[model samples]
Target: MYYNILRGGINLKKENITFLDVLTLFIGCFLMSLSLNMFFNPHSVAPGGITGFAIIVNSMTGIPLWVINLTLNIPLFILAYKILSKKDCVKTILGIIFLTLTLKYTIGLSEIHVTDDVLLASISGSILMGVGLGFIFRINGTTGGTDLLGLILNRFFPSLSVPILMGSADCIVVILSGIVTKEIEIGLYSAISLYIIVKISDIIIEGFNNSKSFTIISDKYKEISSSILEELDRGATILKGEGVYTGNKKNVLLVIVSRRQVVTLKKLVKEIDPNCFIIITSINEALGNGFKSIE
Candidate 1:
């Protein structure tokens, strides 16, 4: 079924998955499994989503975590194959298989048990898992489960955003943890873990190379734009605008600057035009000079 979908949707015959891609996926799976088996499962820290569900099920039924993980991901994988690209489905399948195998072999190893403290366990486990997951996602692959659901939501509702959907799903899974464990603390820790994982995943994926977009609405457009160019060494675009209330013609300055240069740019704008309306926002992935490259 997946094969037919792949043939129809993706140009797989022309674009082959590289060895480096496979290697990265394998390493990502290993890191994820190691984090789960050593840090999370041993400490009963749920990191949300299907992995959390697997942990709860394994706790109750004494079933292998890998088995539960595989079962939980299969349906999602099928859905991904139908709704998303076949290449995505194939990469997710590889990721799940690799993670399952890694977990099976490493489960019996001396559990790291990094910290007996539940809070510490939750934080640390979430960080490692989040970083590993981020690497997989960066390579256009997934660890399967609810991550696929997040992708699906992002595709169908372009305006809804991935973070919002991810948070909603994780919150539901964390709430379910409380019911399965019959403890309020379990739910709390699950929430903490989910938060840490999302935050750390964002950090890992975005890295320190963050950029910001600055929009300035000011009467002193020339002075502000000139100062920005001379001091910040960044280019600015002048957008023609009109104030609705006053019906006054205005030139808005739009610029993209690195995170490090944001304060400098803002100060320059403030000095040039005290009443300038300045708005700055983080750009997840910017492509161009002074930013990220798309290809």
Candidate 2:
């Protein structure tokens, strides 16, 4: 039904919001609230950011996490409206509202008691929270707090990355939480949780359909290209390159292939050019004629 609201369904180039995006935001926010209520809050594990700060405050004041989160974000929402695009700000507001509602209603649905083993709680909570955050990020929605701060700072420091900025802001909260609580272990565990959260979020946002890219530098460029095209059925791009050491001009072959095809491509390249220089690296996502089609 929400898909009908958009002129171009699943075509992200359009400026309007789609129903799928709203659904994703709802799920993402719900998962975030679930992770906070079920895992992080009960165990007193503050993994950083707004939710983490709320946990710290709730522990001390005995206030509900949802209330603390909303109260803290009111000012940030104003700042976000000024700094971020209207669409982004609106989506963030929705995410915050959904998260607050979910926290209020579903906090007591299921309780996880890994408090005895703080490490287990930290790790497990990090995963649940990270996955939720990953989904939110994938859909281009944020739950305000450090996200908005990161955006505001990014405008001033264009060279700095937003994730790094946000992570740094979260770290400050975590470190201060540790200081305030007078527990070094809490900070350390929070750091571990934060690391896991970032990693899991990255995997979720980028997806697991990872691929390898190969850059081949060889004199037998023609043969390598032909083998890749005819045998592997993969496209190869030949780029003109010059060697700095020898001042020799050569053609560099660039090919992107699935992880399973890495060995085969290596063998094929070796067969044609034994003395060729080949560099292979992992790529997040590859979209093209033979790979995943982008909509």
Candidate 3:
């Protein structure tokens, strides 16, 4: 009985600490820390969300950024715990802890003057911060700020999408920039920073080597499948699908290929069977060979 209980407990723990989850948290925290210390702090640019609040509070009170970051994140974390899953809350906590520690230890060492140019700082900081946030989100965790607001919106209004909610939250922050800093330049830089960060984060999390999922209803199934494997060096899975209207049996060829190879694959299918019904969609992250590695 004791041995069984111990084994069960070990398995339970193992289930919690997945390799992908850990990697996501580590990368997310690292990017966020780097962006904060290197770009945002040096220029005193607020990029929005909890970090923005932290920066504003830090500037006004002279408290360390890390302390402000921790205090600001706690209520957001609690909101996340209540609205989101327990696992998400735990992962976010771990990410926040790592971010705080990195900021506390490394902020002093990072270059305080990357560039005197405000535009450069705003752009670079936004990109780095967005990429970091994206990585965290990819693993179904958030850094606790506007993310909590996003979650609350998602929970209460399931129809409203994340992007819409995020936009709404960030817009409020941008408007609040006027109150934080008197100069209009600060607000402009803040807006620029937010834009850069969001776009970059989307790209990073989606990855450069994205894949397209193609569903082709072609008479030349064998030819198309063989060509995909031989020419594209990609794999195809065939599903037995039936036409709803005609009640006719159809051979549906499903294949995933990189963005670079998508045009080629489409052309090949067209050449093989002009009448082929093809549907192509984007797969944000594909793991394994020719894709994102979970590890």
Candidate 4:
């Protein structure tokens, strides 16, 4: 009975955490804090989440970012601990401590003056924060913020969903930042930065192994499946599906292929059956014979 929360979307088994885990957490927290001070905090660009809100507070009041993180995260952690298992709270606790310490130590980075342009600041900061969060999430931990708040709120309102709640909170905070700062551009730029953060973090977590998946419905399922296996050198699974309108049973062929083989697949299916129904989707990552083997 453990509750594991990943900021992006990674689920690591709850087992004995080694030194590597600690090192990874430290590095992640350090990078996030560094980005905050060097880029986001300096230029009044709150990306998203509790830290983003803290950035807004810092811009309004002269409060230190680390203090705000420490102040806000403590109560959230205490409240959330009521539901989250002790085993699950271990990395969360470490994540919070490491992030707080790093933010405090990196406080001087703000005055270091890395870049004057806000656009450059947003991109660089987003990249660093994304990478940092990716590493932290990969280990089944979070640095206590709206992420924990989202899960806690989900307990009361099960229908809302954690991601939706988290997203709503972040959007509100980002909008508030823009209004408070008296610049509409702030919100727009922050939104862009947030988008970049999510994308980069997804790439970091899932990897750049973009693959294609096909859901094929055709009378020539046998030929299509065979062609996929032999010519495309791929695997195809025959699935039993019933037509929603007709209530007739149908043979569905599921195929996975690399990006390079997408055109070949379309051509092959067309040559075999010109009127075949094909639905192609881009997959983030796929593991197996033709893809990366499970390590």
TM-score leader: 2
Better of 2 and 3 by lDDT: 2
Collision pairs in model 4: none
- Per-residue lDDT tens digits of candidate 1, residues 1-295? 1134344554434346566776888887888787778777776667787778788787779788899999878877776666665567667777888999998988884255567787877777788788888888778887787777877778888898877887788788788777878888988988888888878878877776778999899988998888887898888899999999999998998999987888888787777778889888888767877666765
- Where's the lowest-lDDT run of ten residues in candidate 3? 1-10
lDDT digits (tens) for residues 250-282 of candidate 2: 899889999989889989988888999999989
Of 1 and 3, the candidate ahead on lDDT is 1
Which regions of candidate 2 fall more than 4 Å away from where they truly are?
Answer: 1-15, 109-115, 152-165
Per residue, candidate 3 scores C-alpha lDDT tens digits across 1-295 of 1112221233324336477777777878888888878877666678888787676676677787789888877777776666665566566677778778877887774566788887887888787788888888777776677777787778888899876897787877776765777768877888888878878888877777668899999889999999998999888899999989999999899898888898899889989999889999988778887666774
Candidate models: Cα lDDT each: 0.79, 0.83, 0.78, 0.88
Better of 2 and 3 by TM-score: 2
> If candidate 3 were superposed on the true structure by all CA atoms, what would the RMSD be?
5.4
Q: What is the TM-score of each candidate against the true structure?
A: 0.82, 0.89, 0.73, 0.85
Ranking by lDDT: 4, 2, 1, 3
lDDT of 2 at 123: 85
Clashes of each: 0, 0, 1, 0
Candidate 4, 220: how far from true, in Å? 3.4
